[model samples]
Target chain A: MKDKTSKNQVLLKRQDFLKGMVAAPLVIAGLPNSAGAKPSASDAGNNVSYLFDSTKCIGCRSCTSACNQINDAELFSHDRPLDLSERSRTAIRVFLDDTKDKGTFIKRQCMHCLHPACVSACPVKAMRIDEKTGIVYNDPSVCIGCRYCMVACPFDIIQFEWDKKFPKIIKCTMCKETNLKTRGITACVDVCPSGALIFGTRKKLLAEAKKRIKKNPKKYVPKVYGEKDGGGTNILYIAGKDFDELGFPKNLGDESPAVITESIQAIYSWFIAPVVAFFLLFIPVSKNFKKVAGEENEG
Target chain B: MKKSEGSLAQQPLFGKIALAFVLLGLIIFLIRFFIGLGPTTNMSAGFPWGIWIAIDVVVGTAIGTGGFLMAILIYVFNKGSYHPLIRSAVMTSAFGYSIAGLSVIIDLGRWWNFYTLLLPWRWNTHSVLFEVAICILAYTIVLWLEFTPVLHEKGEDSGIMKIGFIKSIVNKLNEKKDGANKLLIVVITLGILLPIMHQSSLGTMMAIAKTKLHPLWHTPFLPILFLISIGFMGYSVVAIEALYSSFYLKRKYEVTMLRNLAPLTAALAVIWIAIRFFSLLSEGKAGLMSSSGTLSTYFWLEIIAVIIGTILMIAVKFSSSPRFIFISALFLIFGASLYRINVYIIGYNPGSNYNYVPSVMETMGTFALISAEFLLYLLFLRVLPILPAEHK
Candidate 1:
């Protein structure tokens, strides 16, 4: 937006010349490149894999209990969690399928996406994606409690401590520190006797998910979970019924949130280039400005 | 400041009234410290930010862009004609920023540790807030230093020529004043660079939360939108301040320069609308813009205000009408302000679960910050030759 002080006046010759020289290329660079646009969901190896096959599971809340115990989360009164809450890091929400006439439990936690928006959105690198494990982590000590990460998370997995005078952001770390590292299994994965939840590398899990769908197309939902949802999550799921019936958000592509912001920010950063171009054009504009000023003085 | 001009220190009625309101606000602000954000503000977990963050800091910084815009025009661009406006604009920018700095203290739950941003080793490069904090701090210092010439002029005019204790201190500081002022151009450059970096980063701060913000506002272009609007707001503030001063002092308006300034304002407004238009269409949220009930109303209001402002400005371009110009410029400011508030809070939707409406104290705190700014502006212009000399 240009400043509004000079409404009716013509652009000073020098101003016009300088503006044209600097602004023309900016407009050119700002043009959208439709040809080079890529699919939103390709994983750059940032994902934490989880497998949940409803057919193999029972309706036990042991996973939820174990998660709470390991994380020292708030204790819910009821044995079963029908909803996802701030304090509850992970929960199994049940979905009743009308067409298939079956009950499936969907475990919800951080998707740990390949292009995690929280990590990208964090201005101070407070949220980081561990290269080795693909775990999305937040350093509380560095967090200013801005809560922008909470808004960026598509799954609404992140929460803030609003009541605290100085609060820390809270989210699931995938129990990687305890279960996967030392115990060789996650709290939820270890405790699930029904083989409902399986944990492994995203690549291995994705292949296994595809294999299950291929072996029995009728039994599975034909689509492998996390294959391309919001740029693909590390967690994969194979349900006996349709995924949407089990409360999965449908139509989420593998597109990373960071891409959109980067494109715009990239355009603004192009300010330096246009400015340099203006400098290149400066000699002519400066000459024109002096000439105009001299003419005005003569008149 | 000269003996011939007599004492300009006499307070105007408006200044006294403005000071009273400022004191009231300060008292209310004191109450906020004793209590907490919870007792004072409408902020919630769902909406962690409120008007203070959006209006007092974000919009305030943009409105303060006058100094930067003028600096670029005069110093960098070497359009020396614009230099006369720089001092007054810089004074306004200083007050705007200082108030914003105070608001930051109010906004922070753990403000004592704000100095943590200054720690070299503790730097968090990934944190946008950290960047904003450091830049604002440095810029405030720059603003005061830039206005040192006004302080020297004040001392000289007061007839403290003898090198007494305080006179000697002032003289020592003012020694080789031209060299000192020339050496400080680096600070001026930072003043221009820092606002650009931090103000845009303010918008980038929101870009991180893609899902939380309404689709109407949730674009990668948020930073650009913020930057442009600030550019527009900067001029609007200058226009407002100049006009108000002219009216109060009963001096002839700098009509020619102001007329030129109007077109720039219009251009920025048009640019902002264009980007918003494309961003919405490309993002595939145009339908939601019109269909979303409450959000749609706010969206329309923003659009209508901008359009009216644009038309008014264009009309003024063809022919000048003071009333129309004032009305249109006012509309432009209203539209820009609403758009900013909308992007930060109104357009945001956490979930259907929670709601936020600012409490009285929160509103009072914001008012208090503004009052302080107005009060300081009044005091500075009186004591310092910050305002340009009225044309004979």
Candidate 2:
């Protein structure tokens, strides 16, 4: 009886292994065409962009105050004009230079990368980049206030309202809201006496940025900030000194961080495949136990 | 010895208290909806993720490692004798993950938009949390589906007396037990697959925080380390749950099954320690321990916990006492939780200027969550046929 049972178990094992081998490819083939099911590209808005030249910025808090007024937001501190507080969407950060050049001002806000980590990190379709202008914007209604976007931004440009009863994220939308809703241009650009912050298309700013660098090769650093950094951000920066001296993160690559991790995670998450594979493998592997249970039931 | 006829109607004292506690926690959670996380939590710009992300969701899901342990037994090891424990372990997993889901809803600032996470358009397949969320959600459904037969069996016998209308349907379904058992094999197999994917994805979440997380915990081998630790912790949770159930229910201990569990737990611990050292050496982060002034303390603390935890389990090879096994399992549990706490809280640093301390209320809320889970587990085992009948 034992020998006969052992033979039946061997047959069962062989059948299962064969079945699993046949089923494996079919399972992979049946997987939803993940690429085809991607989100619609129709939400792209106009390609409005920002050109920030650090040498021209006077560090005068005029742009910061203008952004607050344009956005109709409150100030964190009324004692002095706030510099990029939770309420202030954008401002100039001072990077004191001790070399031949005097101190320079660096504008701080979202880079609006061609491929953004914040948009990818938002569990909801809350954060998205406009296809037309490539402006990264957040829909507050859809935002769960997870602040994952803050962690994911390499530039550290995104700020949150920590003190508010119902806090929302604060970021430089390139005055897209004001420009799109009302015919008024970006408040920061409108108030800039030195023309430090310019509002235009990214293509125009890139051309303008290149012209300035070519005219005075000795005046600016060899690198163009946001040109190809983290997959080409819309907010371009031209500086007179080394980028890091002006508080920029050094050594960030052009490749989007989200792109690298997605393929690896997606493969393993297909739930139906592995579970089916396991059972096909197990039914034969546990034949001895099954036979024993079957015989015991008969007894 | 006295034997009592098992009826689903008899409610234990623990059951009533558990229900009351869940009710109270729900009320507090409702209040959290009107107000924001700022009022209820000590969350700041410096510390955006606090106890909710770390202890309640991360640690809570890890504690549900029992199902994984059972899966390894019944499927991988081909230990069919351990079948009875599968349903109960799965039920625990179901409840544990479902509560993690609930904690997530409570934690979100914009809870209304949570459906976006489920929307097909919003799936960020590359994201670790996305993978974790999808897997955990699917696993919760799979777990309850797998445990339904246990309910149907009990309902067939006494569901009429406890709840009248449900019995007739259960009586009809009981006759189809053979077909259902075949379906159960697929469900149980999913129980095994979901954890392996999601638990590793959980580790992948911290791996992406390479810039923010401390160097000691942040290594490329982080996912592998997380996988090993979760498997070890899962076995430990199974041991802890079984031991607790044995004590409270006054039933004969399943020493034979529990004995086999130690070797697997020990093996995973050894693997966990090996990778921890290898990754640190290769990454050249060995020097960070001495260089870091304050974080150095936590580095040593994590190292000691893993080392001492593995050593305790090793000692049990010579000593056969259940107490030693329990203590060793506790060490493993402590080690795993510390690893999570260290990665999420102690090691994470956004910048130098800001400081944050978790408010007392945040800690209390975490305590309430844990208390509530334990209370339900007690209530569930008594009311539902969660525990197996004592062997005659």
Candidate 3:
């Protein structure tokens, strides 16, 4: 009786392969959910930051042109890229309300969030954050050109090199590889003669923005922008006008979309949830397919 | 073991017109390779992704869920009487997914580095698109494998396998067919598993967009909503395909089977409508459904169309005629496609001086991708034993 039962088990081994294949991914896939992509106070590494004061911006756009020259020294074109384009990395746009008052000129570039939506959105890690510098950057070589990063960025700074055959994402990289490396300052910061754009560690720049706002409450908005905006951007802004009047989104909450998106995505990354889901799906599908196959054999 | 005597191209006027559109699409598709996306498409920095992504990759794949949807119905739900419908449903998915995969390369700026997607170390699993890309790729391959029995059946008797070495492989494939089917039983489950991952991730892609997406459409439940929406969209296409095949190919309709499916899909659509409404109300954007300008117009239109389709789908269960099924399928397809287009395009305001409307060439590119799907479907129907054998 024992020999016959062992033979029966041996014969049933073929069915076991199917079950094993279905079960193996569950075993191989996941560990328990760990500490996820929650944001901490000092998450944006070392936090090199840029501070811009709109009150001092003369609307001359010299810094914009300087940004064009220093980032891609080979490109000769320096006409203001009406809206930032592949050729133009940083842009100074003049925003006017419905009243169309003598509009305020605000410069726009990558905000380089502490928890970047682009970093979270890039499928290939083409966009990433530098741990030492806390600067968000893009690696064109790894980008599969899915454009998910472009869709995710709340700042609307990221653009595509749509016209080129060998195109890359066209956005500000905070001059991490260029002027920031050799000269230790961005081209825009170096060119801002009026002291509108300044660079320092994030903690220093943020404190400086608050001091300026505190000293002359009538001259500046009381709030230091990016203190809690877009999951606390590395860029700080203190403007004469309200962010809403200045054509900035009024409610760029302290929380990043990255954190929100990541919390939801943690299940897949944790591995076990999808593995369990696969096993649950497998049971019914296998049982039903067998039932149908048996009937097909009969009919 | 039987086949249709005539292919789609054999139809008198309709066949010629389809072939012409497909040829036109092919020519335009090739033209894009030389000229680049900027000159050929109306996409800009303000609007990086346009119709190709919004329509073809996102919504097209939603339509492609027909196979997985049917897999759930026949296998998971144990509604095995719908078994005759399975091969054709899988064929629809096979064509839809394979074509969507092919056309996405045209949209990618760096098409040569497309191979980087396969490199494991490069993957950013935190990204919803990463999950979507991996799942779609796995599902597309699995979908084709699921159709292998159909291919084997056709190839065994067809002219091509008569070649010497090919014939030996075909015989080997034939001999292992039963074993393959058992394995495919596992695979079909995988096919079911993958779509749930990717289809929901498609919505998660937008969820990360935050304030860029209009408040009316944005919600934490987007993934669940998208997961449910595909059931109705997939079922609608399955219904449409059933009626179209019966009408055009001189085959009988799976009337009772399709009637059974309508209630399941309608139930899904009902859940879809309720969740969308409550998601709006909870998000406190429900009032914007009327007060907001053109955005509200599109939202109301999408909801009303789905509501009408849902009611008609419920009515489809009470009747035998295929007309209501076809009309309701059209409405549901329109409604679901409109919802996606609304989320991806109309409502995606990244708040800069940026705007987008698809260029003539961009629209043509979309038409070409769609025509390729049609051409493939017709060609497959001609070559493979996809439609059911006659009962008599």
Candidate 4:
């Protein structure tokens, strides 16, 4: 792109330089591999995890009700929230099979991944992740609600308060600021009557999930969901039905999306790349400015 | 500004019509503060960003790329023959970026908290939006300052320098003040550096979206692709602006200048198209172009527009016809603009079942922003020394 801007009326027209400009993308294509140190997802043993077993879940909406009630403490009613929204921290959905014969009850909330994209996507650090618990939370006051987090979330979990005069972003924080602060457990986990939802340290819950899968190989899916999904979610799932049918996003490989973005951004660490580029531009610009000024003086 | 660029006895008759759109925009722009985006925009949680982002901010900044490119040619490369076009291009860049910044403020849900961008602790270096916001903020100031010499010229002509306060400010900022103008190099250099960083980051912003943006638009080379596309877009915008002034203002067209520029503009379009298709093929996503329902139609529509624009430029490479150059550049801009629209809006597949179409107010909002840009630009042209004195 720069070569073509040469002053020679024939400079850009010179086939050799235009060829170089056209092929400039080759330099950029080499960036991803050559840019920076690649950091893999964090593996913290002490991080908290939520285990939701779809096969063990009842049709009752108690967990969803409790989540809404806990988050919205002013409310006395615990009526079931139909879906996850600005106020609803969690919801349970039914994915029915063919012929409407059988349905799997699935719970939905933020994945709170070890490398949550929302935390990375946030321009203002409004989306914050707990170092110990990996609880991804949104600070409403700091958010300049660009909703880039909603765009970046692989699960489409981050919700926006779209209808408000001054909107705020909403998503699951695993009650890190509320129930977990006092009760030492999430509201949904406390209210789940069927043992469908359980809470423990990330490493222990993952071990438990693997043990269950190993003990009941025929009954459970052989894989522990989220063990590698999107570089491992703190919210682990074990379901009998296909994850695609269970309404879980498919093929979120071991790499989190943030890994690529973070690495790319690191190319300009402390704004080194841009500063170098400015110097490169300066050398030519100042030289040319001298000539332009000299000509003006002569005129 | 030492002499006017063929000023009329009064402002052009069409200014009132442009002012009409500006007024409409002002009303809607005011309404956004009182009302919520839910009622005004068709955006839901499913589709968070709509035309305000795709058109106003993304495409809007691209329209200014021509100024950056022109500055590189005239100031950096010593293209004195190209000097006549510099002031107008810089002026366009200033207005384009100021509008984009304004659009961003209106689009934000908590725009007042944007001051957090200045806070070092809140700066997320990993976030592409952070880089984009910082660069745009800096560059908008650079652009206005780059065009400050014209303001100094205009102020002298209009006798506004009679005011002591303004005279002091203008004297300090004036570039024509002999040896003192050496400092102009920094502002000029920054103007080029900022665009390269922010425009590429605009593309990289979507790279993190991964599967959310359809495979056709999402590539590891997004930053590179965006930077190249801006190359063609930059040239075409300058060409179109000049050709437009020639026709309406009845000034002599920079036909020879534009004719010489034609081949480079065509080459850039070709470069962009080549990288785009190569990325599509190498990524094995070319298959999606044909199979992905209406998405395929949009993909072809965008690609075909650039191809046609390329052909038009090649056809007129040797010709001196102003009409042909105008048409070719217009097609090129349309294609380049649609390419951005496709990338930011159409080709972006948040997921199946998540759909968006800009509501009436949202559509008006985008039009209003563009209209406001033009309205202000027309006013500047009338008052300031943007266009150069035409040769006999």
Candidate 5:
């Protein structure tokens, strides 16, 4: 009868320990907003943005040439760059339908997303957002050139310097440090003859995109491409055809990649903290428990 | 009560072949460094990552997970009978992670700036890759510390007193062994925690590439799936290593212990497959299986590999045979490796035009890495007291 009571007591203690181990992590994981909560949309309004009107574009390569002249050396061989490369920060991609009749020229560059996936994916903080200008920038010196940003980018705008022995990621910086500082605007916007590329604050550009769509419902696609796609890109687009038909990524919903990753990571981090604590505590606790059990066996 | 497991392997033929591959791979690596990635690799702007990141770092680390999984069984769960397997498991993990670290440097475009990964101020905590990198680095250190007892044991047995300089170092290490043993519980606990963190983070790294990755592989449940599958792969690797060591080195087969392990792995495999299918169904991505393409083919191949592996493992007839157990392990490793490859390469669609095929040099580099791992494993088994003195 005494042995049975002691055995039950031991079982109860073990169960209590197990319960503590499980509950500790649950409590920690439920901690209020451990990973900083998502930024409100109003907080992103001050960012620098681009307004690209595909209806007005003539497929001319002036912006591409201007971007090359500003960002790259004179060693570029192409007369009209068809795609964004290490030397080409931006390009004009011509998308045609099955019949090849309804052609649309989309100017491609960095989206500078409000919740940029590149910024979230970089192991090192080489890819950062400027607090003052709200422009995403890449620091080549600090970058280990993992190219994870290139993989994470939904717009597929980031390019790599594959030709260089010491490579760096290449993308549009909105002329923040160079042209915007020295010449007051971006080189591509300045050289655009068709008035397709316009640079302004995100709020103003978004309003302009909405106004263009509202004024000409039949002429435009009745939507702003970057307003909610991938949780809102700073670069806004207005096209005549549906954005998906014009080769824009359609599957990326309104949630930011950062939100998706961070939410999961936050929960993991919370749970890991308590689990690690349990393991650390288990060392001493188990030592004492073993001693007691050993005594019991001896007795 | 302790017994010796086995002695050093006598055959040098395997080691010699591995060395030749290593040398050939070194030449190609030099060419890669001097001529640039463009001339040497098939990687382009569209596909920045290739087999190095897919096979070496991602799958390679999963292969290394044997140590932590065994640590959990023997230490955390107090399954002391499995203790003999822990040293070999830790040794293999050390080699695996160290090679993965080396592969990371080789894959980096600016290899010279690799130190930035260690800089605390440079860390991006928001990034999943950051967590993986830090956890892997910490785990490698933990693994080395855990393996130190073998070195101390070797020093004590192999007459380290005859060597003047070596004697002092060994003595110092021996003197600290008691304290290390006391702290070993903590180290073993860390070993368990770190792999769980990093292995899952590896899958989380892909979460950011939602649009680029195929619907078949890119689910929010990736972290959990990766964690469970790696647990399965870890045990499989342990079984394969034990069986190979027994066959090649003329050691006694550890069939009884492995028999217990096979069922656990088979159960985990079922859980992994079920979770995969359930996630696909829940996410409404089951329609992707109907698409007659390379992506679907690779997906089905992964599924079939796991199914076959589980079948081989669960079969009552195969439970006692080391040879069958080894074959089952191979299938598990293959399935896990193919899953990583499919997620990172085959299932990845940056666009319709973008395609990547590893160059001969790139393929040689991967082969070199595996060969190096085998060679090192052999060397450590011979020199260090990694294996038990004999099978109990």
Candidate 6:
């Protein structure tokens, strides 16, 4: 009787093992496509771009004051006018070479990358790029203030409202909901005296940047700052000095950080790996189950 | 299994310390809510994530991985003899995850808007954090359900029903015990699946910070590394908890089962170290180890801790001794936690200008959170059938 029962237990275990193997693949098939289903390319065409020429900038803090006034933001606790914070939407940082004679003023704000890492990092669609205008915006209503966007952003543009009871992410939106909506131009671009800042379609900005570089190769850095940096940014810069010397991130490849991780996720979420893992794990489970059953029958 | 595990001990000293910590933490939390994150935390724009994320959520959840590890061993691997360890591990995991969830709420700048995380329509499919959040939420619920059987078992065996209200609830729970047990198969499977997804997703969360994170700790293989380390930490936590319980509660030590687990723990630790070094070499980042910096120091410390812990785990003499096992478990937990801290904090360099250190209140808050977890754990162990019944 014991031998027959043990034989039946072994058969039951094999059947259970087979059932687990079959179930794993079926479960995998039901999972949503691992590749992000969003349309990636459509938003680029409509994106408004900025052209900031450091050669034309005169170290005047007018644009900084203009941005602060327009945004109705506060001064940073440290009271540094050049630093970007929740209270300061934009800043013009003055960089001097070792000689201290050559000073370059660079305007810094949100790059508004075409493939924004902040948008990809936000778990709740609080950070999003507007499909129509291609402006990156943060919705405080839905934001949990996880600060994941701040970490994901290579440019370090997103500032937090650390002092506020109900904090929100503060980043340049190209005056999408503010000055641009009513005045047809960003506050800083509209207020620049030296024509250093220009607001237009990304195509026009790129052409303008290229024309400047081609016309005066010696005067410009020979490359548009955001054209291919971090998978192309809406905000472009034509700096007289090397970007790395002026506090810009160095060695940033053209690929967005989001693409790197998302692709890995896609490969793993393809279902085959997980199914194989389940099958591998099931073997021990089946053997142990049979042994226990056989032992029970003997007892 | 249905019998009482043991009588509750008069743990006055522990109870007092836990209450004091909880009270202090509550006071700090009130200050934090009123004053905002800036005053209470060392978080800046450059250093947005602090210990709240690194210790509470990341390390806390890693420690909580005990339940899933045991589930994999018992349900997926079908090692039924390990069943005695499952309930206690599950309880610990449930508490760990619950504290992590609460820490997230406390850490969020806009805590009121936290419900947006639950709205499926707002979910970002591309975000790894989204997967983590959803999985954690689901797993916490599943863990609680898995724990109900313990409560039911306790209610059925313990006859001291002094309070009418309490007695009625126990009766209801006891009445549903059979149905709940039947449903446990599905719950256990889910409990196994959810942790695999989230624990790795936690690592993926750090992967997005490519340039900011130091090369020593940052790799594209972060998800895999995290999963393996978490598995090692999970077994270590189980070992520590088992040994501690046996010593303090005066119960029989499951030394033989724990001794059997030593090889598996050591093997996982070995695999983790191999993968970590191999991935670092493959990324051409092995040169960074010699850099004279805080990050390099922490990185070497993490590596040393793991090596020593693994060596101890595999050594026959050390693995056999309860004291050595406990010490090794501590080292493994420390190594795993430091790895997470290095990944999230030490290795992260937003810029030369930004610096952060946890404030006094932030430290107190973390302490309180841990103390509360211990208090709850003690309460559950006393009242629930979490431990195996002592043979009279």
True lDDT of residue B369, candidate 1? 78
lDDT of 3 by residue, A240-270 (tens): 8888776566456877877656656766644
lDDT of 1 by residue, A87-149 (tens): 567788776766657678788777777667777566456677665566787876665555556
The TM-score values for the models, in the order shown, are: 0.78, 0.83, 0.91, 0.91, 0.90, 0.88
Candidate 6, superposed: residue stretches over 4 Å from native: A1-43, A73-80, A267-299, B1-11, B156-179, B316-319
Q: For residue B7, what is the lDDT in candidate 6?
A: 29
lDDT of each: 0.68, 0.69, 0.80, 0.79, 0.80, 0.80
Candidates 2 and 3 compared by lDDT, better number = 3
Model 6 steric clash pairs:
none
What is the C-alpha lDDT profile of model 2 across B65-170, one tens digit per residue?
A: 7876686676667676766576567767777887787888777776676777787877755466777777888888887776676667565456333565555545
Per-residue lDDT tens digits for candidate 4, residues A185-255, read: 99889889999999998788888888888888877887777887887788999988778777666555677
Q: Residue-wise lDDT of candidate 5 within B27-96, one digit each (tens)? A: 9888889878887789987799999999999999999999989877765666766777878889899999
Interface RMSD of 3: 2.4
Off by over 4 Å in 1: A1-48, A54-60, A73-86, A94-105, A176-182, A239-252, A263-299, B1-40, B76-79, B108-137, B156-173, B248-252, B278-289, B317-324
CAPRI quality of model 5 = acceptable
Per-residue lDDT tens digits of candidate 5, residues A1-299? Answer: 34544565466445434434454344334322213223445556767777999999998888887777766756454568777778788888998977988789999888888778899889899998776556888998889889999889988889988877877888999888767888878888888898998988888988888998899999998889888888788888999888887767768988776765765565444345637665675675356435433443464
- Which of candidates 2 and 5 reaches a greater lDDT? 5
lDDT per residue for candidate 6 within B307-348, as digits (tens), equals 999988888344457778888888999999999999999899
Give per-residue CA lDDT, model 3, range B1-392, as digits (tens).
13476534566776667667777777776767776788888887768889998999889999999999889988889988888888878989988888778878888888888888889898877788889888988999999889877756776668656777767756777788777667787789889999998998788789878878888888777887889999899999998987776665777777887888888888999999999998888768878898879999999899999999999999997888888788888899889989999989999887746789999888877887787788778777767788877672
Docking class of 1: incorrect
Off by over 4 Å in 2: A1-47, A73-86, A95-104, A159-169, A210-221, A240-242, A266-299, B1-27, B156-172, B389-392
lDDT of 6 at A79: 36
Off by over 4 Å in 3: A1-35, A43-45, A96-101, B1-10, B160-170
